[model samples]
Target: MAFVAELSRSVQGRVVLITGAASGIGRATAHVFAREGARVAVTDRAQEDADRVAGEIRAEGGEAVGWALDVADGQAIETVAAAVAERFGGLDILVNNAGTTRVLKIDDGRYDAAWDFLLPILLGSHQRMIRAALPHLRRSEAPRIVNIASTEALGASSPGSIYSAAKAGVTGLTRSLAVELGREGITVNCICPGPIHTGMTAAIPDDNKTIYARRRTALGRYGDPAEVAHAILNFCLPASSYVTGVTLRVDGGLMVRNA
Candidate 1:
């Protein structure tokens, strides 16, 4: 009973705004924050799904609000930021989790259209959302930003060439933002997830996922949403004051040579 209360009060009253909260990692993250008593602002491209997630959180006795947010649209991002701040009175954490996977080859003439569509949601949206939420976040004693990157960022690009490039930019953004925001008591970090089975990966046939897991990951299995959430939650807690500017890979030990 005591443990339960402690867990519940862990992030009590903190305002967390998570983009792409409609499903997958975003939905999982929303549950993580709410379970710990944070007032979560759920925003996604799909308004109905976002609302359902928020409703589920409220039904579970947590505070939350849902808003339709298309990160590709600058104005929509601004509107969501304002609505989130007003709804929660302030914002403490911003999770840039909105992105999509694309199977594209760089040499193909299709590169132009592909880059244009993926860049904004994957890499560009991070800064835009951060700018819109900075004023409110700056007001909080403990502010955090977690950008969701991909393992492809480091690996030689194959399947998602565009996604890989964009995520690499996200990693760069994380480092730069951490250095800049540290003095302001705002910690910035990023996660590189390898083969986490989300809505995106689910589209791939299970046999293919198994083959990839065998080839790439030492753990020989895909991680669950909650597993990634734990790593994210750590950086979010006030206890993580000393930890900043780190790119923690939540992959099941997908080998990427640092040298």
Candidate 2:
């Protein structure tokens, strides 16, 4: 009974700042945390989308605010992080989920462009956001950082090598930061989601998605954004204090299948 009560109140009243919260996994994460009574800062590159999501949360009677944030921009990161910390009184959870995808062959003309564009947003932003939120997180009783990586980090798909590389960097960053901040009782972790139905995959044909998921994922289906969100929520719980430096695969056993 005591354990259940403590777990229930674990994340209530904590301030959570999530990047790319306008849609997909980020949007789902914002809703899940808010449902758990966490005050949420919903940020995205698109100001209107961010506003819309935040508004939806407010309509659901959750505490929230929205901001336009380009994770690739250092100034924007610092500003938004500061504003959210101030608005919510302090930051307790940081979910670095802002990201997009670009696929190009190694020899393609746009390969360099894709590299420059993807690396900063996917890999570099995590570091910058963590740095920006470090001060407030240090002040919180149970600070948690959850970086959203992808299954691409473990296995490669043609023309997505760049994306895979960046995600691999996220896992490495999670481990390094976890070790550095563990002494402070700040838990840093990573989530690697596989074949989630997000905007990035919206263009993929339905038949193709089903075939791919059946072959690659043990669950034989692409996961919903909310499924990944729930995993992120679990890591942010105060009860997860002892779990740090863990790179959890929220991908329905996608990596375990040999066939």
Candidate 3:
């Protein structure tokens, strides 16, 4: 009840857009933001999952809507941005959370495939969405952009993950945009999440998790999607008004050990 009251004071009546809201961190973020009274736009490639997230938020007495989106398509992003503006009267927050990658070494024949797919989804899409959503974001008094990167972006030397390289671009974009948008009173930051216990990492064996915990993480465990969501909510809150253009890592000390 205390947090509920605080939600009303901190996040009530804001319009929020989150990509990749079908599952994992994006889904957790949708719940967190919606609970705090934001009018959440739950968009993902999976129509069923996106609909369910929005439905659940509405069922819980929060304002929400769902749309199937391919973040790699800039035109589609523009269309969705327009729809959100019309439906919500404006936008206050943007969470660019959709991402993917293929594991391929440069020597592999499929390296081009990995590069093409990952770059568009991870970096190109985030940039396009920002361009499409800028006008609506500019209208808000407290506009916030939370670009999701990865701990790999912080120079993790993750040779196994093509996603890591793309995320580095996202981190760069976050820093640059923070400066460009600062004059507009819009705050831009990034979340470089570590190895979270999400669907994408489900294939990692228990042994590997144990090894990673012991060797890499000071916290000695994997992170949860909700944990990353909490960091994201921190950026969107009015209390974080002074924090901008920073990459906050939610990596459970993976970077600390590696660094």
Candidate 4:
């Protein structure tokens, strides 16, 4: 817990809104942020899971609240943003970590599968959240947005073409928003993670995982959720105000190796 607490640079009293807070990277990030003394708003499509995360935070003596949100819906994002502002006074951080992926090759006669599965969550949801939170973020003294991406955005080409494209769009959005919001005291950045052990990755066949481990990753294992959370915490620090528009890769050197 102390180690986790040290990850954040004293964000005590800051308000953070995290999307996809039900489980996986989002849940892990929420826990890390709460431990570091941030007031967290845990949001997910599943109301029960969101409430559970909020309860765990409260039980640990952290300030937290849960909201059910369909990140793909603009109206829902707007409503949740308003609720967060009213509850926490203002927003300091927005983490666009909600996404979905479907594995389908471009040459397998299923190219559309990628777009159909990833567009709504990756592109649509991120834009909606950013739009909804912009007003409140402008009012805060320090505002940050962290967009989660994948190494595929840089041309990995394993999971699916759609996921790659969507993540690439995320990278683009991070840079664009960083420039658009820099003068307003808002910093935007993206994180590109390699193969991580999460529910989403669990769907991949064991054989494929083994192949990926053997060939791609220099660490010889999938990345832990905490590793990504650590990077997220770094982005939310006030000291990182000048670090916007950059994509930090947390892939354990996988992207550089073609094993």
Q: Of the candidates numbered 3 and 4, which has the greater TM-score value?
A: 3
> Could you tell me how far off, in angstroms, the CA of residue 19 lies in candidate 2 after the best superposition?
0.3
TM-score of each: 0.93, 0.96, 0.93, 0.91
**Candidate 1 lDDT, 136-240, residue by residue in tens:** 989987888999998888785565778888999999999999999989999999998878989988878999989878777788888898888878888898877
Query: Which portions of model 1 show Cα errors greater than 4 Å?
Result: 1-9, 256-259
Task: Write model 2 residue lDDT over 122-160, tens digit each, in one string.
Answer: 999999999999999999999999999999998888978
| Number of the top-ranking candidate, with TM-score as the measure | 2
Worst 10 residues of 1 by lDDT: 1-10
lDDT by residue (90-164, candidate 3, tens digit) is: 999999999876776668888877788779899999999899899999888789999999987876563555777
Model 3 global lDDT (CA atoms, 0 to 1): 0.89
Pick by TM-score: 1 or 4, better one = 1
Q: Relative to the unseen true structure, what is the C-alpha lDDT of residue 127 in candidate 1, on a scale of 0 to 100? A: 97
Which pairs in model 4 have colliding backbones?
A: 215-259
Candidate 2's error at 213, in angstroms?
Answer: 1.4
In candidate 4 the C-alpha lDDT for residue 138 amounts to: 88
lDDT of each: 0.88, 0.94, 0.89, 0.88
lDDT, candidate 4, 1-259, per-residue tens: 4553323367888899999988888998999999999999999998898999999999999999999998877788999999999999999999999888777767776667657656988887888898899888888777899999988899757657788888999999999989988888799999998888888898888888878787778887788888999899999997777789999999988877755
Candidate 2 clashing pairs?
none
In candidate 4, clashing pairs total: 1
lDDT accuracy of residue 178 in candidate 2: 96
